[model samples]
Target: MKTYDAIVIGAGPGGYPCAIRLAQLKQKVLCIEKENVGGVCLNWGCIPSKALISAAHLYEKSQAGAAMGIKVSGVELDANKMQDWKEGIVKKLTGGVGSLLKGNGADVVNGTATVVGPKRVDVTRADGSVEQFEATKAIVIATGSTTIEIPTFKFDGDTIIGAKEAVSLRRIPKRLMVIGGGVIGLELGMVYQAFGAELIVVEALPELLTGVDPDCTKIVERKILKRGGTIHKNAKALGYEKQKDGSVGVKILADGKEQTIVVDTVLVAVGMRPSSKGLGLEKVGVTVDQRGFVPTDKFCRTNVPSIYAIGDVSGPPLLAHKATKEGEIAAEVIAGHKAEKDWVAIPGAIFTDPEIATVGLTEAEAKAKGLEVSIGKFPFSVLGKAMAMNETEGFVKIVADKKTKQVLGVHIVGPEASTMISEASLSLEMAAFLEDLSLTIHPHPTLGESLMEAAAHAMGAAIHIANR
Candidate 1:
């Protein structure tokens, strides 16, 4: 048996960073992973999906270069080559993670680890060998989550699949039906749509991208419609049938009616469930909620002092960046440093056609809290940069306190919205007021200037747009 100061189970965005940080803090750490080191985010979810989205975006853009006076011809998508390129990116990232762990002096073991006790873990290696390791100080559970499969639409890895399969499609489907309209579903669905697949999104919720700013979501919805994609909200995917022609017939309940839609593929992207079970956490007295989330305090500490949880296994807003931050906090706290999960907000970015990014509260959320608010919106259609790029499909919206003038939230749906949201996140973090943002000199004719203009519009002092 080997003993270490800390043991991190699952070498994902949450676990690897915790181990690396612990090692950096002069503590001995072991990071054990059942599969690859980089976990789903790096290996399958975030990296691969983004690569495909980028390629699709470029492919779609290449077709319109004639209008820009740049003659372009023979624009095409080579699926196998695209898949190979995406896999190469995944390899580079996962390899970099392994090297970083070794360079940082953190030990990594390839195996499935289960907590045998509060401070002990049993790891089953790939070769059917077992090893025991003890954590002298703490054991961090960063097991992450798995894709949720509907009972009736279980993944067959072919006809019906999850986000993992959707990102790896080698051929564009003639017709694609996505069961969920959340981030994973829409992002991947739109990728195929860009590649010439007819898309049908059936979301059980009342709206697509639920909890996102409805106004921002509206732009994406409009784009999907313009692309000849179908959307059904307030709908449920009851089940699916295997067609004789190697296709899928999905039955969806929407608008108080049942309809069967036939498609070449069905992407089940309802959501993810925490991989908290089967880890022997219950025997060690670790508390996992009914929804499979391991509850943690501000410091990422669980009920058991020596046991901690982070990432998707920990709680909501299961973003890769959120998991990475939590990992750092847990490591610092375990190393006797003062750190906690303290942040104004966790920003979200959806890589739809025009993209949607947001930070802090939405208008409805603020209204629900009974706060008097002022909203300002600036359309990208009127922006010099957006017009120049020929991508003027969305806008920037700023929500602020009516009296205090404190900026509450920033929602954007336009070109580079994902890249533009970091500034808004920083503004919220610094508690910047509407005046602070409005008066700040943003670079002229940039997408970022829209943010400054939106702030000024909230105060009825905008120059580029009519003040409300």
Candidate 2:
């Protein structure tokens, strides 16, 4: 009959934040985790992947440094050492998360908790003991998604692999076939590309980065192509079979015909579906849609009273930041505080070489909605910062409503575009118009100035480039 104010199931980027916030608000909170407290993001997804990518980036930079008047000798790739370094970062981060939760007065229960009722869960401990607890107030589910596997495929976590295995591989594959050219696919492909792998990306879509700006997509493709990598768009992966030599045999349909490609490794980056299974939602009368998303309000309350769900199990965008924000809103709502979440735009970014980041709507989306929009673009080739960095192969584009001058969208494909999109995200959130951005001052000889120039270009007042 033990009870708590709030019980957060899954101590991920979302759940832990909610649990900590609730505890800080003077609530008796219990955070349950089946595996490591930091969950997939800290354990597998973001931190580990980024750690490995950091090594790859530094190596590539050192290689490029030779051309830029910096000399180095005897560079080598140590897969085990790279993995150990990345795992060390994860260990430190997850340990920090555990300490924060405990220090915040949150009870960190190390076990899987299955919902048996609207406000109750059955916890299965590591030692195979079961304990039941009732949540006196709210129950938050933040279980994130897992990698999807194709039918008739064996996931050895080595040769035929997913992002998780691809990140922690001991040896680099000479050639890599990346299936499904989306965010995960492109990210890993670029990682391997930076590590000197011959990469081939296959996508079933007519265009790369569906729902992204076509102009941005074109720039990314051109950059990858210039690097001697191959991309086959509008291609379907039929199936994969083992080769005689134990490499991999991949059957694909591209250029309106069937073909086979042999490679040492295959990284399946199709996509991820929500992990809303085995929690007994139906038994408790909680409604989950066909897509497995637990629908919620702005405050993230579930259909059932005193029940809430956040993060990947909830819905789209599946971003850690989105989940963290949603966790705050849910926590505040349970605490009987006025909490509202309004986003004009949730910017999405692909962390590839010359990263791609976009906020608000794309040109095609605006055109589809039949809005008269003024479009403005500025190439990175004209920027002093890009030239100075010797990476001038992208642009910044702005789309605004022709009538109201409201900034509709901002898209960029260049170095650090992921970090640079934060300004546009805030501007869009404030519903700032093109005039607002045009009037804002931006310091010269920096990457941020491109945004200001693009905004001015949208209003036909740009000073740097010729009239558009």
Candidate 3:
């Protein structure tokens, strides 16, 4: 039997950071992984998807460069080469993770771990070897989630697939049907659409990207429509059939009517479910919820005091950054430091054509809570930078308290929205008032000036745009 101060399962965004931080805190930490070091986020989800999206954006821009007087012909997408490039990035990052863990003095074990007791874990390594380790202090479960595959639209690794396969497709389909209008679906769907695939989106909800700012979603929706994509709201993808000519016929129920849409591929991006099962958590008396989530307190501790859960396995808003933050907090707590999952908000960034980023309370959420709110909006179309970049498609919206002028939320939809959201997140974290944002001098002709201007508009003192 091996003993350690702490043991972390699943060497992912959450687990790796936790193990690294624990080792930094001078704890003897043992990190176990059943797969690659970076987990799904680094290996399959975020990094790979963004690489493909960036390539697609570049391809689209090259074709549209004629308007900018940068005319060139014969631009082609060698998908094999692009895929190779993406894989190179994944390999480098995952390699860095392994190096970081080892450099930080954390022992890395390649195996599948199961909780055998409150402080005991059994790791089944390759070659049918099982090793038992005891966590003298804590055992952390940082296993992430997996994509939910609809029973009817089973993944064939070809025509019908999930996000994992969607990002790795070398052959651009002539027509693609996405079964879900949420973040993953639209982001990847738009990538293929930019690469010349006609897109059809089937969303079960009344609107696309449910729970997001509708105004922001509207702009992306219009862009999809303009690109010759079809959106079927209040729809359900029943199943798919393989056609004789190697095409896929997808059956969908839309607006109480059944319809069949033939396409080359079907990408099911409904959502991801927590990876909480088959870990022997039940045997250790850990409570796995009906939805497969391991409920935890702010300290990331489950019902068992010595056991902790973080990241996608714990709850919703399954973001990699959030998981990393929680991992640090958990490490601090285990090190006898005062740390908890305390933050104003976790900002969300959607990597669409014109990205959408948001933080803090939304306008509808504030109104629903019976709060009187003031809204300020500034369109990117009027910004000089946007015009220069030829990416003027959306706007910045600020929601603030009507009585105190305190900024409640900030939403942006335009180029570099993802990069621009950190300021909004900082404002919320610091509880900045509207004047704090407006009075600050922003550089002239930048997309970020829209935030300052939006704040000014809320106070009816905007310079560039007429007061609302």
Candidate 4:
């Protein structure tokens, strides 16, 4: 049997990073993965989804290039070709991850590993080969998450499918019904909608992207409606019945009444659940929460001293970046370093049409905390860059404390909103006040200037908004 200083199970965004960090710390680390090295983010979720969205954006712009005397003739999208290209990108990225791991001198084992105890892991290889890994110091679990299935809606991987299958549809559905209006649902829905599908989304909440800023979500909902997508919220999808002709009949409760909607395809994007099963947690005396999330302290360390857990399996804000940071922290702690996991500003970005991003608390979250707050707004419609791009579909919003002027929240919806949220995140991290951001000398004629404008408005000194 082989022994190592640390052994990480599941080579994913969380696990792979932890493995490499430990190796860099001069530890003999063995990382085990049952599937591909890059896991779902590169293999399925983040990379492929973004590629499809990029294609959708290009297609959208090409369709409207004729407005300024720019002659556009024939433009059409081949779904199969796009899928092939997306697959190619995923392969390249996953391959890069494998190379990075090996370069760090981390042994990448190909098998399913189970924790026999705090110090042992049984690696079950393919072809019925099995071996055991005895960790001399620590073991980390970063197995990640999976999509939850609706009670009565079964996934057929063709007709009714999960986001995995939705990524790989050979042909676009004439009428697509996406259940749940969260990030995954809206993202994939937009891709198909941009490709000219009669898309309808049914969510259980009162509105789409419920936890996000309400006004901003309303703006996104309007944009989606303008793009010919239908939304049904506060609706409970009870079950589904397959028709004789191979169509799907979705039944839901809306406004205290039963309603049935038929569609060619159904995409379930309810939410993600932690993959805490079959890891032999019970054998190690490790306890999981009722929802299957591995409970951990602030350092990503579980109840056991020599064992740790991070990422989606550790719960909420199951983002790849969050997992990545937590993975780095856990590695440092395991390598006998003094480290603390504390991030005041964890940013959240949604890649919808008019992409939305927010850092720290929302307006409601701030109000709930009983803080006297003043909010500022800067619409992208007035920005030169936004208008020049012909993508003036969003705004920048800032929330600051009424007394200290310390920024508490930053929300944005527009082009490059995903990239812009990082500045807000850093400001919140530094506990930056309104003046700190507003007086930072933002360059002219740029989308980033909108952030400065929003901060200026929070100080009641915006030049863009007259009479502020």
Q: Which regions of candidate 1 deviate over 4 angstroms?
A: none
C-alpha lDDT (0 to 100) for residue 387 of candidate 1:
88
User: Per-candidate RMSD vs. true structure?
Assistant: 0.9, 1.4, 0.8, 1.1
**Per-residue accuracy of model 1 over 231-295 as CA lDDT, tens digit each:** 99999888887889999888889899999999999999999999999999999899999999999
Cα deviation in Å at residue 68, candidate 4? 3.1
Model 4 scores a TM of 0.98
Compare candidates 2 and 4 on TM-score and give the better one: 4
Clashing pairs in 1: none
The number of residue pairs in model 1 that clash at the backbone is: 0
Clashes of each: 0, 0, 0, 0
Q: Model 4, residue 285: displacement in angstroms?
A: 1.1
What are the runs in model 3 whose C-alpha is more than 4 Å off?
Answer: none
Q: Model 2 over residues 1-468: C-alpha lDDT tens digits?
A: 689999999999889999999998999999999889787789888788777767877888777886688988888988888888888999999999999999999998888789999899999998999999999998999997888888755578878888878878888888899988888888888888878888899999998778788888888788678878989999988887788888888889999999998888999888888888988887898889998889988889889988899988999897888888888888888988988667677888887776899999888888789999998788889999988988887999988899998888999999779888999888888889887887888887888888888888887888889866
Worst-scoring 10-residue span by lDDT in model 2: 151-160
Per-candidate TM equals 0.99, 0.97, 0.99, 0.98
Error of 3 at 301 (Å): 0.4
lDDT of 3 by residue, 209-322 (tens): 998899999999999999999999999988878899999888889989998899999999999999998899998899999999999999999999999999999998899999
lDDT of 4 by residue, 1-468 (tens): 899999998788999999999999999999999999887888889889999999999988888877656776688889999999999999999999999999999998999889998989998889888898899999999999999997688788888899899888879898899999999999999989998888899989888997899988988899889988888889888888899988888888888999898889999999999999999997788989899999899888888888899889988888988888888999999998977678897899999898999998888899999998989899999999888888888899998998999999999999999999999999999999989988999887889999998999988999888535
Highest-lDDT candidate:
3
